[model samples]
Target chain A: MSMVSLTVNSRPLRADVEPRTNLADFLRDSHDLTGTHLGCEHGVCGACTVIVDGEPVRSCITYAVACENAQVTTIEGLNDDEVAGELRAAFTREHGLQCGYCTPGMIVSARDVVLRMPDASEHEIRVAMSGNLCRCTGYVGIVRAIRSVIVERKARGAAPRADLRTALGPVGSGHAGAFAGGADKTADAPPARIASPVSRAATPRETAKLDADFVPQTSFPQSFVVAHPVDVVWDFFGRVDEVAACLPGASLVGTPTPEHVEGQIRVKVGPMVAEFQGVADISRDDARHAGRISGSGRDTRSNSATRGLIGYTLTPVEDGRATRVDVSIGYTLTGMLAQFGRSGLVQDIAGRLVSAFVQNLEARLGQGEGAPAAPVVTELNAGSLVYSVIVSRLKELWRKIAG
Target chain B: MKPVRFDYERPVEIGAALALMQDEGRVVKIIAGGQSLGPMLNMRLVQPELLVDITAIPALKRIEDTGSDLIVGACVTHADFEDRRVPDVTAGALAGVARGIAYRAVRNRGTVGGSLTHADPSADWISILSAVGARVILRSASGVREVAVEDYMLGALAADLNPGELLEAVRIPKCSASARWGYFKSCRKTGEFAHAIGAVLVDPDRGVFRAVMGATETRPILVIDRAALFGASGFSTGAAEEVAQAAGMGDLLDRRTHAVALRRAFEQADAA
Candidate 1:
């Protein structure tokens, strides 16, 4: 626990709070101020809006420890406030609420809108209150209530509080003293409940079902050229162990057979990291110089699972002196990581991951047989993450295991 | 959702924050307004061992008007710009853009530097700041370096930050009397991540006619050759098609939205 001193609802309070405890949790759980609501713990849903240093902020995302020496006010604190009082009456008259779960935050945000833009039109009021989402009333009653309050307040000769905040930094920041010696209070605090790391080999593999007719959620194409001839590159593709070594962040559980292979691949994209471990099936057609590898894996940490199918064909270029590899990857991702992985960003990360894999493959091919494999790069190149590395490794491992 | 347990340190000095970042073998993240990083942290997408809060640093909160430019501290909130709490050098360009970021509550705590350093392609600052030719000043234990906002973001969620380096301030050049700026973003709902963003700054006095096609899933595509971009009339749809193609936008709808956004921005600038 860390010692944090702040004023809550005009009352000076000091508490020993864990750094992970957000402002809403500290208010509701620690101080019995349960007026603040949490709809989505992220900043997207503004249900946790509360007054911090006279400015409203998302309490769910703002850590309590960061609000040291700051003034915070919850919905319960606004009982006697003028604007809130008027809003309460208007909301009741306009039927602005249905369930009232989002009322606390809605009122907090609505109060800010009233003070900041008193003369805001109906459209402007809607735009200003867009952050706070209400499932009921379709926002018809809510917008009406706010507009009525604004119209009445403007008629009362009230002016906009545009300059309510005069400080520079974030609303609740710049008021606290620096914690000496990093987190000194955390040292004396009891050990936190942390999730234990999942061991790779020991954990039972809840392998996803893979089949020939499996369809993918999304797919993209990627290609790269190697300086070596098609036959040489094709021969290199036959060695599954060697091929696995060429790809970054891929490792096998045991020796692979022609029909099935099992392994794991760790993919990192920016701050997110996922290690997927599972099994796959390999198939090849020599006449077409093409092959397909289909597999599925799960990242136990995020509880995200991915099933992918990669098909590759080697075609001769530069009169057989060089080889071009055409790869098509299709994948289905479902879970927490998928929720965060925007589609465009996934494609970008996959594109970069493919280029990095090609570089590693070329380097490995440059070093002839019996020579030590190129240095193992456990991390993807250029800070990339997602399906490409995982798919590419599946293709490479399938080739070696099947050969 | 609650974030993973992590140690917190509120450092009042940039040097102290940098020192915390320099701690080898520790996953350290710098938290300013905790607007962008907060969501990621709550979702467990980013789990750091220690969070170094840089908002209390007085130096990072200092804003100065250099007559020709506004050197805004990294911790300056978007609301600060929206309310003109700090001097604005871009006329109302900064304030206009600030008013549209997220919402009033988000602007209350979202820092300008935090948005830039987070480097979300859909964010407003990267598009408008790059169009305005703003330069970001980065500070580290080694020294300070200034990089153009256009070149600051390497990719999505990736800023060109060396280890221990933090963006200290943004140097936004003042708009001349003849300067005209326009920015348009396409979001299904107000304050949501924009699907397409178009920003243009045409300043004859500054000899800058820069247009940007932003929210491209990577770096924003910048076009400095106004002749090739604009025809004798104004923004040309033909040129927009080429720009969209060059940016590798394959979806026809996506390309059309970006083109229309640019066209609207051009119209807005013309009206200005």
Candidate 2:
């Protein structure tokens, strides 16, 4: 058994819950905050929608322990909300409900729709509230009711957001809390909030983000470019320290040996940054003006391992007036940064870093890093042009970089 | 419906979560969004003895932009994508896909990682991501492997997820600004699970053209080559027929319905 504390409907509550206790069961079976109905139990039915951290999420699947210290606002809390009060009236006036089984879910969803789409059209309203299903009323009445309220609110210039609750006075007080047009609101209620999962049926973490002996790493290809002439660039590349200085939010510091270059590079993935120290075996072929740099290292901070193989070719362009530097880097990232591999974000950032490094290189090359020529805002609807620009940019930046 | 008894742990880090999964005897299921598993628990379709909740692990929620792709953690919720919380590198097609999944509440809770990991063929991300040639990351105590969406999904409600391995994230390659994308789904009604899901992604310059037809049955039919998806007729009835025949989808769906959906997808991508 574990203890959990949360602010539910402006009420601070504490309870001992089972390890398997879900928020829906905790609320309904314990404190009896049954206003947040549950239809499908899965997330499909909007019946379990409740405001958690000001965002409406399905409570049916939310673990009770996960809500520790969270602020939970259920339908029961909307009694004092003026917008909800007004909407309840509109729902009744429009005959928006028939069986009333789906009323709470509808109202909760309607609240979110109004807050998000203040000037929503009829079609938009239908789409926004489509998650909540009502077998009765065919949803036409519900749609009409929500729309009328939106229109009425617009006329009054009343903000769609729920403001500080003003009292509705007594329109006939009831045994239940929800102001769903004088209904017992808790008829289908099964969830009652208990102090914890310590009741007769009651039964239910570490600080690490991952718990693997060795998290898997993904290896992918990434690229970058340089504007300097090939011979000049290759000469510049020979100077490891200068090249390392080019990367923004990154720096590689070390001495170069005849056979290899050893350096430590510090890079910030997000708030968590790591410094990778390694030795690279450099293979340079001046005859072909091509080279391969391979290295292996470990992040001093996270102890994550990293390996990279970068192959480059220097091609003369514009009749040797310019040098085209093409790079193909296949890197394997493991441990702390492996998760970032799935989204392909780390690689994208790697692309951005190269761009930043290129500008930095321009500065190092005695060429002032001018604000890159005004971006060519290719007009929309030109797919062919877009493709060309992207292709050119890849040649200019890195292969398969930005769109 | 309340879930039966089960042990639960909310691991703050991935290492701890993986270690917990390695324990023997108890059946373990990874619960990130709980949007898919929760309902199944209530309906008693699945009742695992233990649930490893990874939502609170901050690292799992991070979004990083790879040069060629925009990779988001598996825990990113649908609303995050819909609201552009992360860098939308899919030319608004990714956001559009997130927006039309279930509804606002589900979007707030249902995660993209979970959607793909669960591998519901009728689900939006499965068909759409597959159409766009996205990749999924699978990690376990053993190691990590990246599987293209096309190869990852085996059939309806089935994914190539190994036991004790969790889906890490999905890598959606950056689409060109003008790359046309069209995704169309036919449902019995609003909010209903899709019946016929068609997606078209075309970037003529890169020679990337893909067409996918989903929700017929066990697996979604796909056409990734440029010629197969965009024949001489350009996704017309005849083109769709050829694609359907090539993809073995003609027997799965009404040829007319398949043709109509294919045409809509092609036209939308062209128009957009």
Candidate 3:
């Protein structure tokens, strides 16, 4: 726990809170200020909007410990405010709310819109209030209420509060002293609990969605040439264990047969990491030097699941001295991670993954016959891949700049 | 969603923050505005052992206008830019871009260095700063180094940061009076992460006409060739397509959307 001192609704309050306790939870749980709603704990939903140091902020994402010595005004604090009074009257007259769940946050955000952009147009008001979502009224009534407040306040000669831009950095920042370290005693604390594994019963749809011959939502092709012959590469692919070892962040959960294997692949993209655990069905054809692997996996932490199909063929290249491997991957991802989908980002990460796999595969193949496979990588460090890719990309960019 | 329990430290000095980063055994992350890291932490996307809050660092909170360049501290908020708390060295270009980032509520806390270091490909600062010819000042306990904005972000969520180093400030070359800048981003909704971003800065006095095609899932495609889009005729879509194609964008529709964005930004610049 950390000690945080702040003035809440004109009252000087100090509390000891966990570093992870966001301001909304700090207010609701500790101070019993339940007016700030939490719709999406991520910053996407503005239901937890509150006033901190005279600027609106998302309390759900902003930790209370970070707001030391700052002033916080929840919806309850704004009861005596002039703008809130007008907005309250307008909202009631316009039927701006029905369920009243988003009222507190809506009022807070709407007050800012009125203060900042007093002369804003209707379209501008909609754009300004886009962060705050009101499920009821289709936002027509909410827009009307805000617009009415702006017009009425303008007629009353209330100038916009252009003076609120006082702080230099983030709101509620710069009010605290240097680090005294965490106030919580660490010697007697217990070990943190391990996260519980995701239950399969929770997501039957993920398993049901994985079927043979099912078309993938998105597919991309990648080809790489290695300094090995086709027959040698083909033999390596046949050994599912060796192949799995070649792929970074992939490890077998159990002993695998020629036709079936169970594995987990941990994929990291930027800050997000997902470890997908599932089984795969593998098939190969000797004549065509081609094979296919289909599987589905789910990451328990993010509750994101993916169904993927990988098809590859090995062809002799460079006068049979080397091998050219052509790979086509199709996948459909769903759930929380997929909701922030950037297929281009996935492709970029996949390209790096394949490059890493090929490098590992080359190293394994050069080990000669009956050699033990290289140590399996438990996690794919995308940061290292990004670094390697950047070095070359930088040279090209500099060259372009020179020209 | 809530973040995993972690120790927090609010360092008041840059040296102290840099020292905290030297603890190699612990995964320590430097947090400025918490606008970008906040959401990630709430979702447990990044679970660091210790969070070194650099917001209270006095040096990083200061912004300086050096006649020819604007030295903006890493902790200066987007609202600081949007509200002109920091001087507009780019002839309102920086303010215009700052206003469109996330929203007013978020802008109140999101910082320039935070957004750049976070290095989301779709983020506005990377594209605009790169176009306006900005360089970031990186500091570590060892020493300090300067890197061009184009070289700052290696890939998505990847900044070219050495261990124990923190971005101190961004040194943006003040645009000449004759400079014309335009930036446009396409999003499904207002204030969302952009799908396609196009920013162009043509400063004949400064001998710089740069075009950037951002939100490409990696380092943005920087078109340095002036004739690729900014010809004697001002702006051309044919050149935008050629530049996009040369960047190896194979998707026809994707290339077209980016080209259109570039063209729109170009037109916006041309008008300015």
DockQ of each: 0.49, 0.10, 0.58
Better of 1 and 2 by TM-score: 1
The residue pairs in collision within model 1 are: A240-A400
**Reference contacts recovered by each candidate, as fractions?**
0.60, 0.22, 0.62
In model 1, the Cα lDDT at residue B112 comes to 91
lDDT of 3 by residue, A334-396 (tens): 877786557887787787788778778878888888996674343566456556655655565
By TM-score, the candidates rank as 1, 3, 2
Residue A64, candidate 1: how far off, in angstroms? 0.6
- Chain A TM-scores, all candidates? 0.89, 0.42, 0.88
Show model 1 residue runs off by greater than 4 Å: A182-200, A211-213, A375-378, A381-403
Pairwise lDDT winner, candidates 2 and 3: 3
Q: Measured by TM-score, how close is model 2 to the native structure?
A: 0.63
lDDT of 2 by residue, B1-272 (tens): 56655666667677777888887876567777777776665544454666777776766777778688877788888777777786777678888888888877767767888888776656888888887889998888898899988667654445677666778778888887668899888887776677678888888766788787776443466665555445465555665565554443334345557667767887888788
- What is candidate 1's lDDT per residue for A95-164, written digit by digit as tens? 9999998999999999998998877899999999999999988999999999999999889887677556
Q: State the weakest 10-residue window (summed lDDT) of model 3 chain A.
A: A200-209
Model 3: chain B TM-score relative to the native chain B: 0.96
Please give the C-alpha DockQ score of model 2.
0.10
